[model samples]
Target: MKEMTGLVNTKNKNKLPGDGVVGKTCNNVCNNKTFIYTRKSALTLLKTAGILLLVLVLLAAFTACVSRSNQEVGDTGTGTGTESSSGTGRETGGDQGDVQGAGSKDAGEFPLTVTDANGVEVKIEKKPQKIVSLTLSTDEMLLSLVDKGRIAAVSYLSVDPGQSNVAEEVKDLQKTGLEVESLIAMQPDLIIVADWSDQNAIKQLRDAKITVYALKTPSSINQVKDAVMTVAQLVGEKGKGQEIIQWMDGKLKAVEEKVKTLEDNQKLRVLSYNNFFCTHGIGTTFDDITKHAGVINLAAEQGMVMWQEISKEKIVELNPDAIFLPAWSYEGFDAEEFAGSLKNDKSLAGINAIKNNRVFCLPEAHLGTTSQNIVLGVEDMARAVYPGLFE
Candidate 1:
């Protein structure tokens, strides 16, 4: 049997503040000036007023009670989830996703609630066994945390060794496109997509009740660690997540110690170059790596807060201390040819990196990564900036 509660109308229609029984009674009492108020008449009037006051107080209390009850449990007919005082979902357990530090709860517990990068709270009734990765970063993070069997598919980018750190392991998994229909066909229990993925596809996937983790691009080492840890918690691999973070921290601390002895002026001014003259600016993973590696990003120095292409004239003017070419190892790309072109460009002839032959082509796997391997990118950069210190 379903239980039901109806709203109580507590307004007292019979009693008003002015112009009624009280008015008539007062008029009659005052009209007879010779009739002085005996104790009996005065007590009768007091009793009448006291009864009206009691009715008003009772109505006010009842109204307040009803409002508070409604606020606590929103429209009960609808199945909308409730939020606690902290804004975390009022599920059996506190928000599993927002949990920090090493988790103590059994991750295998059913009906888990997690807050994704999009700030949407997702509830998983059971552990996700079949996962699909829609981005290269998530592909690498997943492979590092879960078993190969758990990963049903990975993005097409993950199949290319030039663009993915886990390409070797994910080469056998089926590759997926960034289409809603394609994702639906996979019937994934969980899907990990980037924050910038197609909104239409994300909406369609969510409409189909597919659990999607819209992971964001990390701007710093701490954010990278947090991303990895968040995924680990989602995939029931918190231990593996902690291990990866610890490893990254060890590598980063080594670089920090090496750069600790260097003076501020001694830090190298560097620029990251793709095939085109484009580079990442402030609030980017590459920019953060440059900071950790004890080098200044020339693009950031120019007040570029996002990825932008610079004119050849500007490149010559900046004359970076070292030039990092991250795309030199892409399948058919010829590193030597690119280097020759940089050296021969008349506009870039006066650049310090070209003059000193310090243009370095870093391995694409680590250099372009925003995942845990970013620590490797930081280490490689630090080595290039201060060659003898790393050796």
Candidate 2:
């Protein structure tokens, strides 16, 4: 889940103290009070959790991003049964199209043909067989594309039932810990990392010449679809990837249709806050989803995508029509904590959403990963953004 930090509007200097309103329950593994002892220090880069999912999946955290040029092969397979892997489309359809028959990319099934993101050429002898997934989402994505026999080791965190999809598969692996040596020993073919921030781990694996695919964070839905397809191809599970994309697309359309039916005047002005009371602003996936939901994002209005620390005073100034505080308090707090903070704050009474009781809760599961489940979150968002319309 996205872990949030308390913010103080370091970006928007115009906002002052006694701002409009809110305090989120502390998502720190430790319980922190209103004025907890805070130590200010630069955060050294650690491994990227879900890359974007780890940060923005909830309210408290913000996602960090950088770029990369990965090897790529052409998006071939002319939808012909004669192709090496064909009919990888879903029968029910997805946001992209076709889902069924997208698995069975077993080890050594196909020769490894590495394609750089910039369309550069790199050739390899064999496709990745034993893969290690970095985050919960990547592991889930891998599971969807291939079988458990293929995965060498998944992230240790994947055992956190709240965050992981294949809880059963990862349950035993967690006890072992996700150590580097353990991964190297499992050594079969390749290791896939979620974010480039994992360069240290990737470098260690690369020294052994294990094919490491560094996946860049995706901002838009299409990027998600493309990423899945790329990973699928790499694993020789393009069919499985197609199925996943199809599911996502189907959900997107359902969400869009629901959004279109809302009253024209009911365009919700929304804000997404996490357990840390920090808001998700612009350039984040949650913000993109809010936009896609046909609701106006209060954070976007203030130019906050990836959590800009702002005071309650600033929120009052924005005075959004509605507030959407996702419950990413993986630290054991309730989902309603942030919304309650907004509703109960005396100073926040001046804000429009509070006065109107327009704050609503979003489902944690939908908001968290949604690799095979983006549609579920979108549907929940549509319902939350417009309550009565869904029924």
Candidate 3:
């Protein structure tokens, strides 16, 4: 995020002390020993006294104005008295004193600016009343952070129970397409997209004068939290974001505490396998999940990065203790059938997972989630790998 700058000057004009005071002196005198008080001199003295009194009043007003300005700036800039659910001081926004529009006092500061995943400095003029989500991840975060009435539309995937955790909640909401014309028709005040979204589409949206924020896809749990917080800040739901993170933390902490009881030899070697022979490796969220679940990811242990396909020969050689499959099925793929095939494969029969019937199908929503729900994936994997300990 880029640092915000500039000061907010609430008052239109301010005058310094003695700014308009006219300087005058009395000239009449009776003698050197004693000053004589003529009517003219007395009038001049009275005028001088009046000017001094006015100056004093102006000075006091100026001081009060300065103090008030300082307090306002401090309140907005310092994020004072605000802390995350974890008991850490929260940074509201850096130098947001320059913001110029109305914002919900309870939600967040607005007329806010932030650097998006694309490294562009995007400025939001005010709290968005109509928001559009272009990706399932953003869709998930939006549902949890803001009211449904504030959302104009969400991605089509948001209605697919197989792919979305909040499918039921968002089923009644409008599902949007990626077409520029459809997006423009919605007249959204803000549009949130993933980094992988069509750049040409994003450009078209911006060219049409729509506010769009592109978020980076998270590859790890920490990155997921960052994405969640970023969305929360954009939507004036920082507190809600913190709450989601705290919930994730609490769940993960419980799993960690239980995993601590496992000895080194008790930890299992696990592999996340999809129907396509694809597996998540190092630098992927699955790798982080495996680590937290007290299991070794065979793909990551072999120095793989991101999603990649492994050869059947390699799978046989690696011989994982347990295998995880996606719980959801797509158009042509069936998860249960895939698990059955894995169990019946003659070559893979020697594999420990197959022989021991340790093949598990985890919910696709939890396994591939980029939201706070990913913690559920961690807990699921932990339970599947060490059912005895978890029970």
Q: Which candidate has the top score in lDDT?
A: 3
TM-score per prediction, in order, is 0.71, 0.66, 0.75
Rank candidates, lDDT, best first: 3, 1, 2
User: Any residue pairs clashing in model 3, and if so which?
Assistant: none
Top TM-score hit: 3
Cα deviation in Å at residue 329, candidate 2? 2.9
| Cα lDDT of model 3 by residue, 68-130, tens digit | 666665454333323231112334332211121123233366766555667565778778989
lDDT, model 2: 0.54
Q: Give the TM-score (vs. native) of candidate 2.
A: 0.66
State each model's C-alpha RMSD to the native: 25.9, 21.6, 22.9
Give me the displacement of residue 210 in model 3, in angstroms: 0.6
Q: Which ranges in model 2 have alpha carbons more than 4 Å from their true place? A: 1-109, 115-124, 172-178, 331-339
Better of 1 and 2 by TM-score: 1
| Model 3: how far residue 375 lies from native, Å | 0.6
In candidate 2, what residue range of length 10 has the lowest lDDT sum?
A: 29-38
| Colliding residue pairs in candidate 1 | none
